[model samples]
Target: MSSYISLIEKGIHVSEKNVCDQDKIWSRYSHDKVDIGEELARVIRTLDKGMPLHAELRALSIGSSDEPQFRILETAFRGGLYLLDINDCALGIVQERIKRQRTDHVTTIKCDFNRIFLDPQKARDFFRDRLGKRWVHLATLHHSLYYCRQCCWLELFKNLYRGFLAPRAAIHAVLMSSKSKDPSTTTWLYNHFAGKFFGAYNDQDLRQLKKDLQRETVFKKAQVLLRTNRVNFYVDDFEKFMAVVWMILLYPQVHRYSLKQREEITQHVYHHFWRKKKPLTQEQDHLVVYKGLGRRGLI
Candidate 1:
């Protein structure tokens, strides 16, 4: 068996007491009933979609880098993956297991995150000249958590894995929260609730999920995603794609204005749950401290 499969088996079979770290995590968030693993998974996927999968392995190209990219990477290292972006100054030797881990055959595509430009040509050239067809690239986009908040893709990912990973705090919030949760029942109901809320089996009322549940395909797919961090490979599985799509749906605010736009909402709901009510000041013991903005009364 592959090491990745072994890791998945361990994750699938581990007892709650053995895998859960509620006490240590609760102190940080205070009060929440969601699953930590799911939450961490969302945050990791968000970070991965926002930046390179292995930014920690590369040197910081000091420039106008986006915050979400940095934020998610820092979170993932803390959650599991084991590599720290040098940009995360607060992190040191906190994770012992990750220190022994190694990353290979990975390269980040450099570009200005602040700018919006489509380069199908450059992308094609990268594959032609740089990474061959066999090489996989998770192209991340640096978007403002505020401007581009409707993460339907994220909600999709969560809903797909809601059955298995929902026990984790992050998935709990996504599946149970007002926006993502089904309006009715709430009692660790993954299959029923997700089908009702996200229309996983109902898009055309095909009811394909009945067969899918028996196959346990989604669980297998989530295992692959957890180990490899690649979503583009499983195009054949619409259910899996919908899970990632759900994650995208959960984004707080969406800047893209189109006719299909459901409502004029921007900023993710989760952002409000944890967004800073006030700007950074000397009083806050921030790990990434910055000098207060100079006088015009705005710093």
Candidate 2:
């Protein structure tokens, strides 16, 4: 068997054990609310060290944060493994990282206006090639856009599971987020068909003019797809990889949860999962007391 296949089989075989250990390392999945960052980091390191080439890692998340995943990515990248995840973090950071990397080895699938704006012909062609005859429906395109917008990741693999490959393969899978709506984002989606899919530079009149002309073409394309009743928007590929990133970001306590939750989950894993057979004492927790920490957000 290939190294990647071996790693995935191992991950699947041990997944139940990892989840059902005596200590609650996977409390977050059960909605018990615990931070599993350290445990996540430790598992990633072990996998990288052990498998080196093939290790299955998955991420799950809900919310708009990237700092935690950034830390994981930094660690993995520095470790020379470059295997990581980011679920619901800001998409811009993900895009920026890929742009910075700019290599053929990395498979980057995203549905951001910036990418289309930067290169519309390339974007359209990619969808056409990936989706084949299915790229005829507006709904499919919209769903594809959402998947890329929401679910995106970069990785290396010989073959992917059906969930990762199927959606982009034959049909479009629609996924909707219940998160609070943003007017700017919503507006961008509604105007997806406009000739200038991307917003104009800082000039307001120029932006309006661009949208006006593009809306005509957008409507024309939509009408054509509506008549055919067949649409394809490669949502599956985008989201599966996205799930991977989200899982990586969630580990190491980057998203919402109390500090107590973080420590409890960490302690549970280190003690129970690793066969240590003892709780982590307060002294072993290591609370770094750094000063100059200011309020976050509003940035």
Candidate 3:
């Protein structure tokens, strides 16, 4: 198997364990402070103001795992939701949770965005049949872009634009940005430290994507905004944080590292990246929101 696929499988195993032990996972990571749902709700409310009350709003949550973000979206959005993810375990957990809340309005699809993007016609037919429509009013990829292969990210965006998005629809995504003050420094560090990771996006890639969106014929008049925010990282222990980071970064050949090397990396991360106190101070993240009202409401 390819290294990326192997890493994804490992991540799935960890995610399955996390789903099994929800409290343990949340207690270790500071995900509670990340209010992605509120941000998404605000954007939706702002953009959806002029539409008729009964216009039938539809929203999509890509990489929708067993996270609170999906539940929050369920409350904020007026119409049905199409939840998509590659991890079957995560999907099943999310499916059951949403089923408990509202069975009729939520649909879970076990598939990767890369596949859908590659096979546009199949995706169009599948989603159209499930949604009873070809377009969605809003789509979210919250912290999910990092899971896509680097080269395919822009293609994924273009395919999504072609197949699923409504003419006046928008896509909101939360991405990991550089922490350094210098843009060039950030780019260099990202390419050096995380270039090997699947779905990793550096500063340069993001800039190129912005330019590409402007040039694309499908997204004419698209207003894209990339915002940066520094949020507090609260972790009770360093060991737990390191495990989370390993899974998140999908560190290749972790077993190859010697005991001394592992310790060195852990210490570096703890002292440099992680905060020391409660609501630990750490590097901030970048949130990118794209709103495209395709030319004359057509792709």
Candidate 4:
């Protein structure tokens, strides 16, 4: 067996007590949430400018997971929250939270909108009866654009702008820069390992999306705002760190890292990241779109 496998067998790095689960627990507990939390707050605050004050607002959260956005949006606006996610676990978590809280205005829908979002009629047909023809005042694709192919991005945003977005609304999207070279960065780490093993990684990101949106006439009247921010994730435990590695790599589900490939990635992250005490730095670009804002929206 390779040294990586031996480490897993011996359970020295992750832990011998509760094993991998404990590592995951520590990782989640230690993740830096403040920066992203503040970013969301800032974005929502801006979107709040045009929101209906006396009446409740309508919003859609794409690829919704149990994250800070759900809580923030639910509190900031007293309207229906449509949760769209393809992953069962993610949707389940948010659904459970809603159920436990006895939340009335939250709706969870499990779907893979990658291809579906490209088709306007399909999107409208799917959401028509479900959404009661109530267009969203705000929509968010939080850290979920990785699944969307570059070719589909234009059509996807076009659909939102022409179909889902209300008369005066905005869509906020956050994605990691795919061009960064900083080793501590999540972008670099993905490029390093995924490129080495698979020879390919995400070539499209928020920057490219920004440019694409700007070139299109559909968004000519819309404000395509872009900004950058940094956040880091780290844990002393190897298991926890590996969990984060897998998370970043989109392992097991999205990306099929072969067992041998997994072993290879395991060794690389363990030595270079875990041993060196390097955080998985994520330098993300934020994109916000507002159509027909006039002077009401932030320029």
- Looking at model 4, residue 270 earns an lDDT score of 69
The local lDDT score (0 to 100) that residue 167 gets in candidate 1 is 19
Residue 166 Cα positional deviation in candidate 3, in Å, after optimal superposition: 2.0
lDDT of 2 by residue, 1-299 (tens): 48534433333233223211311232212211112244334334433443335433222111212334334534443312221123324445655665686522222233432343234464446445533322210011111222332212111000111112222111111222222133212122222212132232111121222234235432222111000111111112222221222232232222432444333433333233223322211101101110111211010
- Sort order, TM-score high to low: 4, 3, 1, 2
Relative to the true structure, how large is the alpha-carbon lDDT of every model? 0.25, 0.26, 0.57, 0.73
lDDT by residue for model 3 over 152-246, one digit each (tens)?
76777777766777766777766545345432222333443464333344542455566667787766666665555544444564445455544
For residue 215, what is the lDDT in candidate 4? 95
| lDDT (tens digit, per residue) of candidate 1 on 1-299 | 48534433332222122111322222223222222233333534433443444543212211212222333333444322222122222233222212444322222234331221123444345335533432221122211111222333233222323311211111111112112132121111222334444443212111222224335534332221111110111123222222222223331122222322212111221122113231110010000100111211110
Alpha-carbon lDDT of model 2: 0.26
Worst 10 residues of 1 by lDDT: 281-290
State each model's C-alpha RMSD to the native.
Answer: 22.3, 23.4, 7.9, 4.0
Regions more than 4 Å wrong, model 2:
1-36, 52-67, 74-89, 97-108, 111-299
Which segments of candidate 4 are over 4 A away from where they belong? 1-33, 252-267, 295-299
Ranking by lDDT: 4, 3, 2, 1
TM-score of each candidate? 0.22, 0.21, 0.74, 0.83
Better of 2 and 4 by lDDT: 4
- Give me the overall lDDT of model 1: 0.25
Q: With candidate 2 superimposed using the best TM-score fit, by how many Å does residue 60's alpha carbon deviate from the native?
A: 11
Error of 1 at 60 (Å): 18
Count of backbone collisions in candidate 1: 40
